[model samples]
Target: MCGTIDLYYALTNKEEAKGILPNLRFVKETNRRDLHDYIMWHNINHLTKFLSKKYEDAYTPVLKVNNRENDNDLIWKKCLKMIPDFLQIPLSSLYLRYNIDPRDKIRVEEMADIIRDTYVKSFRQNAWMDEITKNNSIYKVHDMKFKIGYPQYILDPTEVDKDYEGKMEELPSHICYNQPSMGKRNRAYLFGAIGSIISYFISHSFNHPNREFKRNGVWESWLSNKSLEESFKELQNCYRDQYSKYWINDQQVDGIETIDANIADNSGIFMALQALKNRRDMNNVRYTSNSNITEDQLFFLAYAQARCSNETVTPPPTSPYKYRVNGVVSNLKEFSDAFSCSRGDPMNPPKKCTYWDF
Candidate 1:
């Protein structure tokens, strides 16, 4: 019963989102509100039924009693929910079930190389950092690892099964099958991961030639120079003040709460722009055939389009998509030069936050 319902939700949602599967064609015209309502109803009804059952019986086995794997339906449904591919369902399932065969290996490698070079260049050119720190940063950038697409081991059935087994063992029994607790756990894990990245960058930045960088779990030792410390604090305060004015839940949210994500968003976009600028192919590319827009304009447009979503459904914890686009671009002098935006223009704000040299 639970398998049937789970498959139904997965298939229906995928079809609605992608307009795939001729049998599910009617869902293509379904209103977004109606779709949301249907999902909410489905969750309330089916999830309750599934969760009330004994844990062992809640999810049916992917194989039948005859020791044969259930045909493509179950696997397809699982693929729709688990995989990140945006292609047609069949192709996506094939990719997920097989080896991680990236079709754009050359392109991915090229972008990675550009990003690495840009980062190294930025580190070396940063005026604020000492010579020793700059050298250390360049060494670290050279040592950085890149994991593109999925891991190759996922293609092996035995390895995939073992991975799932390990995950199941690691999960707390009480929260493993509990939807709300599982969501909370996922959020906690995400926060911890992001926190670790931010902490590493901060600690590495402040590391002294005589002292080793240690993760004492507190940010108190992030800066030692009195003037530099004050500048850092001022930079943070700028972010806090700017982001605090943005509305969340019909009220202004405290900027400090969103600082980490904002920093990541800003830094991530800047690095991407740098990579795009460094690409040799982009030298002759234009935004459009007849439009006056430049390649940089198109780059920013692409970034904005990727982030575009229904703002009404966005959570309070997340910044509005407009802010994500505007906030990042506003801090970039490259953006100002590309569009010839004057310093006091809204897109070229005078008091922009510059956390790192980027």
Candidate 2:
């Protein structure tokens, strides 16, 4: 039975993947000399070290807020990121060696497993989403690919280097930004930095725009229940109102502007907590009781610290770091429970707006 259904989806999803194939498909890099031409345009010798080492580092490290006043450094970092598009293979090789490794996948994949399974439970509980959409969401989660670390072919740099012979064969774009999004500093703080941040990002693909795309990457509606759309809108409005009510940098948050992120933030937090809950002894993420923090609370601390920045609050596309931490935790009853907040307290609001609470 499972095999037959898989076959049917494969047949149906081909067209969807095919439609975008023209855009995503890469051609022989040896044939495309524009990249080389672009490189010669720059100070190639001066950038050699940057390209070889520092450029890759800028991308993999935990994101830091731009509090520094060095405009030149920012420009240099910006240039480093752009160069990867031109130096695909060389940079991929460098990235494989230092940024992340195949071994990192085992632990991160375990994290993905915990989050994905928790998402399944959330789907099962969503009464507003019809059976078809919910089931399809679950299916999509099951089928979701974790493009961990780098491409396997890159492991043999000499062999792939010979094959490319100085041209661009773009690896799948999906894997470009997937660094080792987990930290090893503390066990309880496992999700504190990289884990929940990446988990949040992965869940966003299933949120707004990518939500329209199927497990097969097709842009088609699977909302078997028509009212699901309206319900979603209402839920979005709740986020808008909720975030708007908060103040940031002496300016009010335009919930309308940050709605997508807010929605992702909401679901992401829920998923992170649920994922954390699923871990066996939370994988024994280490923390001494001297800190007076529980293992579960440490996860939230890690989650916030990953988003921590030194810059002042900025306007949306994202809420200020403060709101991203407090605004979110305020609505989570689990957060309240984790900290033993009294009802109606600031962090423990009387009313909550969790996505999967239903």
The candidate that achieves the highest TM-score relative to the unseen native structure: 2
Runs off by more than 4 Å, candidate 2: 1-88, 91-102, 166-169, 172-183, 281-290
* Each model's Cα RMSD: 17.1, 12.0
1-358 per-residue lDDT for model 1 (tens digits): 3333443555457554343334354456776787678767666643432242353243346235547442234545855654433322333335555433344333445455666676677877777666655665566556655554445454455654564455423211111111122222222122222222323243233333212331233334333356755655666677778888777557665577666566656766666665555553456553344566555666666566656677732444446666777777788897798788998998898887765564
TM, every model:
0.53, 0.68
List model 2 lDDT by residue over 1-358, tens digit each: 3333333233236675354423432322333475345445443433443563465465333223434232245657877867767666667666766676465666666777777788888888887887898988888888877765556777577856764674535454545445444454554466555566656776787667777887788777556556887887777888888888988567898889998888778777777777766664556544467777887788788778777898667777888878888888888877788889999898887767766743
Candidate 2, residue 349: lDDT: 76
Cα TM-score of candidate 1: 0.53
lDDT of 1 at 81: 50
Which portions of model 1 show Cα errors greater than 4 Å?
A: 1-93, 96-101, 153-228, 281-292, 312-317, 340-343
